[model samples]
Target: MPQIFRIVPYSIYFWSNESDPLEPIHVHISEGRATSNATKIWITSTGKTVIKVLGENPG
Candidate 1:
């Protein structure tokens, strides 16, 4: 399950596919792609993004 929001310019914000639809999993946000240097965030059930795991380290 992916949740996308309409945001402003230069903001590549979009929820990619979930790791598993059946499982909520750890509720932690991770990089959608292992090889991707992209940033990810943990989201609530209400589709609100939490600032829990922002692994935006310089590559």
Candidate 2:
């Protein structure tokens, strides 16, 4: 399981367990319920957007 950092109103923050699997390490961002619709991004190489959805419209 992943570890949560902070959860703001706009976004939810989480630590990556995929640093070894995917270099640069990353955090998970979710908007609504479930992490399915969340966007995964690289913490080191952010701003370019490398998001991968866990699912579709999990609202």
Among all candidates shown, the one with the greatest TM-score = 2
Model 2 spans > 4 angstroms off: 1-9, 15-24, 34-37, 45-49
Error of model 2, residue 11, in angstroms: 2.3
| C-alpha RMSD for every candidate | 6.5, 4.2
lDDT, candidates in the order shown = 0.40, 0.55
Could you give candidate 2's per-residue lDDT for residues 1-59 as a string of tens digits?
35465464335556445445655655666654436446777654445656666655444
Can you tell me which runs of candidate 1 are displaced by over 4 Å? 1-9, 15-35, 46-48, 52-59
Which residue pairs clash within candidate 2? Answer: none
The local lDDT score (0 to 100) that residue 22 gets in candidate 2 is 54
What lDDT score is found at residue 24 in candidate 1?
38
